[model samples]
Target chain A: MRIQSLCAALAILALAGCAADPAPTEQFRLTEQALEQAKAVGATDDVPELKLAEQKFTRAQGSMADQSFKNARMRAEQAELDARLAEARVLTQKSQEQLTALDARIIRLRKQLGEVQ
Target chain B: MSVFKKLGGGLLVLGCAGLFGCASQGSESALQQANSSFQSVKDDSNVLRNAPRDVIRAGESLARADRLSNYWGSGADVRHYAYLSQRYSEIAREHSNEAMNQERLAKLELERQRLQLALREAKLLSVQQQGKWLEEQIVSLATTETDRGLVMTLGDVLFDTGEADLKSSANRTVLKLVQFLQLNPKRVVRIEGYTDSTGARQDNLQLSRARAQAVADVLIDLGIDEKRIQVEGYGDEYPVEANASERGRAKNRRVEIVFSDEKGRLGAAR
Candidate 1:
């Protein structure tokens, strides 16, 4: 009966994890994949963030795969949030990209104009 | 044309919709007050057009959140993210509009100066005794020359090399024009940006816009009415000379400042 109670407790914990709302599994996968890609881009300063996201997600996926569904679900939720923070860094990088590109264009144009003039 | 308008309309609509979605939530969310740092930052941006220095700093801080939009989109704590995103938009619009207003006022001053100069030019050049003949001559000469209508000239230094900005001397250049317009209070200023043939068309368009905006910002900073300024970008489409020459390209990378006689005040917050 004591063992049964422990099992019941674990099951309830698992349900709580799974029931956490407002995001989808697909979104989780995207974050995971994006984190992986970010890792491959070695120069990216957000690698630490991606790594954190990756670690959380991997743990979450592991628990779910092992049928510790509640634990897995909780980890998954945490992982999703981590991935989003990392994604924000990615967006900031993208915004800076425009400024960089603009600078480059000006250089090239001025060079070309100098050559012609 | 309608299709282009529809697409642009769609983006503006989406932006506004996105803005309001968070606004309604922010109204109800204790999160606004819960995060004092972010909340102070969010609240501080609201002020007279020349927002306090601290307020400007707060607005700049929200722009730093551009990186967090991905997580911001997720369903987890969405209300919080939405509120932050809306705040970012508000800050950008607020500062940009304020800057824009300053540009218009400066341009008006420039026009006033130009009028006085034109009068002097007319007095010297006009054979007639009346100032009317001088005005006629000034008007005639201005219209005949397409490139001379207050547009930045070829070889005119708009910016320092390797920069996406106006030169430091741009302040004086803009101020001189502002002083010109201050002498004549009845003109509207039009700011147009253009680029030479050396860059990709799309980028050139943007470059032109930045150049124009740089001038306009200076004008607004000089106390030009924001409402009286009209900013547009023409990119490389109307190059005055062949891009095949350096001089021509130099001329192309320019901004035009035109004065309008319309008496309507600009920017009553439409």
Candidate 2:
């Protein structure tokens, strides 16, 4: 009876093994990475009005870190919006950077042609 | 040493052959299960061909559900038979269900057509002979009973914001409702009040009950027998719309007519 019970216990463990899922750390990491990518653009026009949304998001996050899930969820939503804004800002900055690089390259080519002439 | 080695080699060959035979037999059984289930699905579809359109559609849905249910496998050869059978059974079951739905839909269509025809005839008879909106109002949302009575809805438009004060606009609505009730005096009147989820749950319930009693009070004033009226409050629990949006909340805050002798039984759609 003891041996049979051991075999049954092993079988149950095998079946239950499939349910032992890890925490969704990967999703959080992806969200964080996306957020950082969005911030690298630094294209905020820096008007006083632009600071309002950022302030709200900061407050929400502070409340969330205090172990308040309700406030955390609300802050996370705002954070997503902020991240989107950051993404747009970064995209504009990158585009401007690219244009500046192209202008420099064109100036260099023109100087080379003048020398050749 | 040579004789011992020969005997061992022969035994190993026999064991390998036996293992191979078992594998082949397992595969054959799996194939049989898969094929039988496939045939079942085919037969189910054949039934669908003659089924009405609704039945056919439901059967199609069932078939897809079956595929989803059974297609997930243990991902092993030994489990191949079970997986195949599951997949095939799902397919077959869905097809059969759809076929049945098609037939049922056809019958519903017939019933609807018959009802419509009857409605037209009733309307014509009342207009040509009696000259009125036929007292026999056929509405879909109300509950049906052996008795035909007038059904009316008086909304929060009659009340103040968050308060159950009977407003002035409520007069016209109440008057109209009163006339309907007077016309069908023997019928029962069920007054139900509902609220949006803006307030505390306890407050909402009290408000609903208050509003319901208010309506009942008005009907009683209009000469409807107090004993004939059944007043109840469902509150925000049975909202007709989602409480998230403003417009939805606006719709949620109201009193609705549930049972009309003419329309049958109507309530917040569950």
Tell me, by TM-score, which candidate is best. 2
Candidate 1 residue runs with Cα over 4 Å from true position: A1-117, B1-156, B262-270
DockQ, candidate 2, vs. native dimer: 0.01
- Candidate 2 segments exceeding 4 Å error: A1-117, B1-151, B260-270
Clashes, model 2: 22
Chain B TM-score, model 1, reads 0.42
Best by DockQ: 1
- Residue by residue across B44-147, what tens digits does model 2's lDDT show? 55534532342333334334434433322222333333332433344335334444555555565565556556556665554444312223332222323333
lDDT of 2: 0.54
* Model-by-model DockQ, in order: 0.04, 0.01
Question: Across residues A1-117, which tens digit of lDDT does each residue of candidate 1 receive?
Answer: 455445446656754755654344664576566566555444254445666767877887777667665556556655554554455445445545544555565555555444433
Q: Which ten residues in a row have the lowest lDDT in candidate 1 chain A?
A: A38-47
Name the lDDT value of residue B109 in candidate 2: 53
Please report, as a value between 0 and 1, the fraction of native contacts recovered by candidate 1: 0.00
lDDT of 2 by residue, A39-89 (tens): 554535262212433564566556545645444444443343345444544
Reference-based lDDT, residue A40, model 2: 54
